[model samples]
Target: MGIWLGALRRPLLRALPTALGVVLLNFALLQLVPGDAVDALVAEAGSATAETTALLRERYGLDQSSWHQLGDYLQHLLHLSLGYSPRYDMPVLDLLLARLPNTLLLMGAALVISLTLGVALGTVMATWARRWPDRLLSSLAFLMYSTPGFWVGLMAIVLFAVQLGWLPSGGDGTVGAELHGWERFTDTLRHAVLPACTLASFFVAVYARLTRAAILEVQTQDYVRTARAKGLHPVRVRLRHILRNALLPVTTVAGTHLGGLLGGAAVTETVFSWSGIGRLTLEAVQAREYRVLLGVLLLSSLLVIVANVLIDLLHARLDPRIRAT
Candidate 1:
């Protein structure tokens, strides 16, 4: 256990600086944009006198030079205070915290669906050889992987929501419906079906293909044949040896995909018209809500960094070969 923990220490320590660099880079680019958050508010406020605009700018420290502003921003970040939102008129961290759970629900559901179905389907294909199930599932998985998430989302809405009236068109739950316990869950699930399916379909394809290839390769190794030759049942050989080795690569692939899942959720949310962080991020961009954009970028970068570190640890555990490093 001590050795295993020691192996993880260096990788995590290295990832910290890389994540910080990403946050700083994103902050720098956003600051370099043509205007700041104060200007957007001034423009939207329209009739505001120049004096009022000047006061607002000073109040928010937008009056500071680029270097001073960045320094202040970094100071606030160090304290875990993301600052206030000019548009939302609330604390940045509070706003994000409120919306994060909803976003997690949508993305989390899709991830769950993808991992379960993708692994099972992939294992089935690799184990079944040229059977009809393998051929059919492979073809379907290919189609899903090729199709765009947004396009798939739209098709689902048009077919199931609009045409068949099977689900709500968009947005959060109805008036008092969300106030009820299970009712909210049911409502959210119905609304989530299209978006989740759209997101999961592609992931399912990617994971299935990756797992199938990994398993197929592992199944042909000399040790695997020896296991079979030793009179172990075919199922036992495949499950204990082939599947275990195949999973090592799958764990790595899944870890790599965590970032993509967070990023891709934006497109899925837009298509489904869900009010999750992805949708919030889109609205922030349209409104030029600089602070909100900053928050989203920071949160995403941090999540990705955390995911990569976790994946590295998992990879080491799954494959003892990594321990030699």
Candidate 2:
């Protein structure tokens, strides 16, 4: 318990400054862009009088200097307020909270699929080593790793949704359906299938290759040789000795990949029209909603920080050497 708490404390300490830096960087970078939300609104409305444009800019604080805006934004952060989203005409916090679950769901599903399948495929590749099975699986992993995720999503929609009618093409769930309980669950899962698989494809390839290399490397260790010499069952030795240690690298890689998963979700959500933070982020970007964008960036940075902290704890738990250190 003490060890875990110590591990947790360290990351928590670092997260504050890291999150602040992210906010400042995102804010500064957005300021560099030529337009603001008012510009987008004016374009959408097709025209606005000079007075009307000035009033609109004043209304959203766009008329303020960048430094002034930054000070105000930081003030809002201190108050736990994400400020307003002119794009959605709501509080940025509210907008994000509403969409966060869908994004988390998509991310969770993709992570599970990728880790499970990647680890299994990698184990198979490692077990087969120089044989045809290893060669075949390695080729597949490379193909998947190289293929773009959006293209995979499009192909999936074409085959499964459009042509075969096996799944819905887009959106998080059925529109206007009065689904309840198990029925609703199944419907949601069905809708998720394509997007989840599409998102997981590249990651699955990555983890599979990683796990294969880790396992192969571990198999050559002195501990593994000793386990074999002790005449333990082949399966037991492989599982208990080789695979367990092999997972350390995989776990570390997975932790680092969580942030990438969120980034990928933006593309995936756009592709599938999932009502997640990722899609909201795209809308925010398009509308030049810097407040909303900053909120999202801050939240994302915090999430990654928290996730890596948890990963560190898990790593220590898995490897006694880490715990000792």
Candidate 3:
């Protein structure tokens, strides 16, 4: 209990400085973007005189020095203010919060599907070893891993939604349908299938390969040999002794892949028209919505850091040897 508590504490303590660094980095990089929200708005409003543009810049404080802007941003951040999105004419944080749940739902579903299916298929392949089933699984994993996510999403929409009319092509739910109870639940899921599967494909391949390798490595260990020699059932030996130990690497890999998953989700979200952070990011980039972009990047970086810290704690729990280190 003490160890577990310590594990949690250490990460929380370390996260503060790391988060501040992310904020600074995101702010600095956002400044490098080619345009600003004022310019975007001005362009959209048609021809603007020099004086009008100057007033617009002054109104938004776009005339301030970069360093001064950073200082103001940091000050506001201390009070949990994410600043306003001039493009959307709202608080940046509110805009993000609105879309956050959708992104989380997509990412959570994809991760669960990938990890569950990958582990199962990988275990089957490892058990079968050099058999045809193993070869087939390996080939599928390779193919999925090599394919691009957006392309897969487009093809899936074309086949499943457009041609077959099996699933809704895009959006969070059925349009104009005041769905209640089960209908509402299923409708969201129905819309999620293509996007989730598309997001999970590459990750499924990753986890499968990792699991296969880890299981094979664990199989050769003396403890596994002992379990087999002690007359344990083959199933018991594989499940209790082999798979448990093999999962450590999979957990680590999953943690490492979280950021990539978010990145891919952006592409997938755009392709599927999902109203998630990824799509928001794409729009922000195009419109040069600096505050929104920075907020998204900072939030994403923080999530990745927190996930890695949790993974480390989980690793410690799974293998006490890590706690000692």
Candidate 4:
């Protein structure tokens, strides 16, 4: 209600300025690139006539001053009218909307797998920290985290798709693979395997380490000591008391990792040719399709903002210390 809104006001206000900054910085960097959209179109058109260049420039409002262009760009951004795409010859937003689900699917599936497996492994390690299994799992996490994304992706493709003949090699579902409703759902999931595992392995490693550390810290706290002294079963004490309290920091870290997983996993998508935001961004870069590139930046920034906000809420709920003004 009003009380929660009051509590959230500061963070919400901070997000506005952060969003504006991201847009401004992203637009400014694009403007600073070596060529303009008009230049790109003209180069591709193969004609250097004055009339044609002038028409092209005017079509995109490039004749305006830098400040004017920036202001206009911001205004369009507010309306979600991200302008036309030079390469695709369609609205930038349209192209992004078309491609967003594929990327989200890949990243989302990977995140779920990584977080689940990671928490399980972490709990086991924390439950038996001094055992050989704990040491072995820790070593494995370290190795997985250190391995490069591309290398792992390539290996998975080689082994799973080519060597074992288990999954498709790359790209979306098979040619014309009924990409709609329930059928496409399963198809996309099937093709998403390599990219997801490539992306998830590193995250699993990081999350396992984080969760293990958090659990270990909670195990040493005074309440945990009291729980042990009481007649409560060890499993119940660990799960309901120690583990729950330890999850606050781990939740915050995992939230941040989730954002990084989506953004940083660009290389994995590119390697797998999964047609996600990462792949879109690469295509935009190669073609100098600045609008699509800007859209990707906006999308990523929004994701990061949303993730941080969710984490803050989760953190506040978990730790009463966050409720203080």
Candidate 5:
């Protein structure tokens, strides 16, 4: 337990500074943008009167200087206040939390699917080495890696939702119908299939390549050779020695990419019309909702930091050398 706690200390300490930087940078950059959220709301409502604008500005403290606003925002942060979303007319934290679960569900499913498929394909390619099967899988992985996520999502929707008339085109679940129990669960899964596949494809490609390379490298290690020399079964040597160490790198990549999947799937979310943070972010950007956008950025940065810390812990647990260090 002490060892695990020790392993986490440095990364957690580093995360504090990273999170502070994200907050400062996001706040300052958004301040530099041309207009405030009040201008957006007034324009949308077609009530651009000076009095109304002034009142809205005053209400949200937009009338303050940038430095004062920054101080206020930092104060709000200290109190766990994410400020209000002028567009939604609600607490920004609440708005973000409401949409967070959907995003987590989507990204989680995609990550699982991608890791499973990537590892399986990678294992096969490694086993095959230079065979036709390996070549074919490698080529396919490259294609998936190069293709844009949104385009893949669009194509999948066209083929599965429109062409085959299977699966809902987008959204978390069917909107009008009341569903319960297994039915609702299956409906959600059905809706998630296309978007999840679209988002997972690129990750799948990345992991497959990473896994293959890692395995190939691990296979040449002294321990692996020693295991083989001990008359262990080929499968046992491969699984217990080579594959285990190979997965260390794969795990690191997965952890790093998990952050990206969580917050950077804006294109896939938009293409699928999924009501995730990415989509909400898109909406916020279009409407110029600075507070909400900043809140999202802060949350995303925190998640990435948390993910990295967890990855370090996992690494310590998996590799004895890491714990010793």
Candidate 6:
């Protein structure tokens, strides 16, 4: 327990500065863009008088200098406020909270599917080593890794939703159905299938290749040789010795991939029209809703930081050497 806590402490300490840096960087980058929320609004409205434009800018604090705006933003952040979204006409934090769960659900489902399938396929590849199964699975993993996720999603929708009529093509659930209890859960799951699979595909390939490599490397270790010499069952040796240690690298890769997964989720959500943070992020970007965009980026940075910290603790638990150090 103390080891786990100690493992967590370092990452938690670094998180604040990391998050602040991300906020500052994103704010600066957004400032480089040509227009503010007002510009987008004005364009959408066809035209606005100079006075109306100025008033809108003042209303949203867009009239201020970049440094001044950033200072005010940091002040609001300190107060746990995410400012307002002119596009959504709501507090940025509130708007994010509403969509956060859908993104989380999509990410969580993708993670589980990727890890489960990747590890299994990797194990098979490792077991077969140089045979047909290993070659076939390796080729498949490479194909998945190279293919674009959005293209995969489009094909999935066309095949499953259009051709076979198996699942809904878009959105997070069936609209106006007033689904309840298990029905609601199942409907949401059905809608999630394509997006989750699309998101998982690339990661599954990555983990599979990584796991196969790690297992092959571990199989050559002295400990593994000794275990085999003891005449243990092949399955026990494979699982308890080979696969367990092989998973350390897999866990590290998974932790680092969270950010990538979030980025991929943005594309996946846009492709499927899923009402998640990713979709909201696209809308915010299109509308030049800097406040909402910044909020999303900040939240994403914190989530990745938190996930990496937890992964560190898990790594410690998995490897006694880490705890001892």
How well is each residue in 28-117 modelled by candidate 5, as lDDT tens digits?
899888998888888888867899899989999999999999999989999999998878989999999999987887888998999999
Question: Candidate 2: misplaced stretches above 4 Å?
Answer: none
TM-score for all predictions?
A: 0.90, 0.97, 0.95, 0.91, 0.96, 0.98
Q: List the residue pairs that clash in candidate 4.
A: none
RMSD of each: 2.3, 1.2, 1.5, 2.2, 1.4, 1.0
- Model 3, span 180-274: residue lDDT tens: 99999899999999999999999999899899999999999998999999999998998888998899999999998888989999999999989
Ranking by lDDT: 6, 2, 3, 5, 4, 1
* CA deviation > 4 Å runs, candidate 4: 1-7, 41-51, 320-325
Error at 223, model 5, angstroms: 0.5
Error of 5 at 81 (Å): 1.0
The true-versus-predicted C-alpha distance at residue 118 of model 2, in Å, is: 0.5
Off by over 4 Å in 1: 1-4, 128-133, 178-183, 323-325
Q: Candidate 2 lDDT, tens digit per residue, 1-325? A: 8989877888899988899899989988988998889899999999899999999889988899988989998899889999998878999999999999888889899999999999999999999998999999999999999999889999999999999999999998899999999999899899988999999999999999999999999999998999999999999998999999999999899989988999999999999998998888889889888888898899898888888998899889888998888
- Whichever of 2 and 6 has more lDDT, that candidate is 6
Best by lDDT: 6
lDDT of 1 by residue, 251-309 (tens): 77777777788778888888767778888888888777777888888887777777667
The number of clashing residue pairs in each candidate reads 0, 0, 0, 0, 0, 0
Model 1 residue 135 lDDT score: 96
Error of model 6, residue 230, in angstroms: 2.4
The CA lDDT of each predicted structure is 0.81, 0.91, 0.91, 0.82, 0.89, 0.94
Which model scores highest in TM-score?
A: 6
- Badly placed stretches (over 4 Å) of model 3 are 180-182, 323-325
Residue pairs of candidate 3 with colliding backbone atoms: none
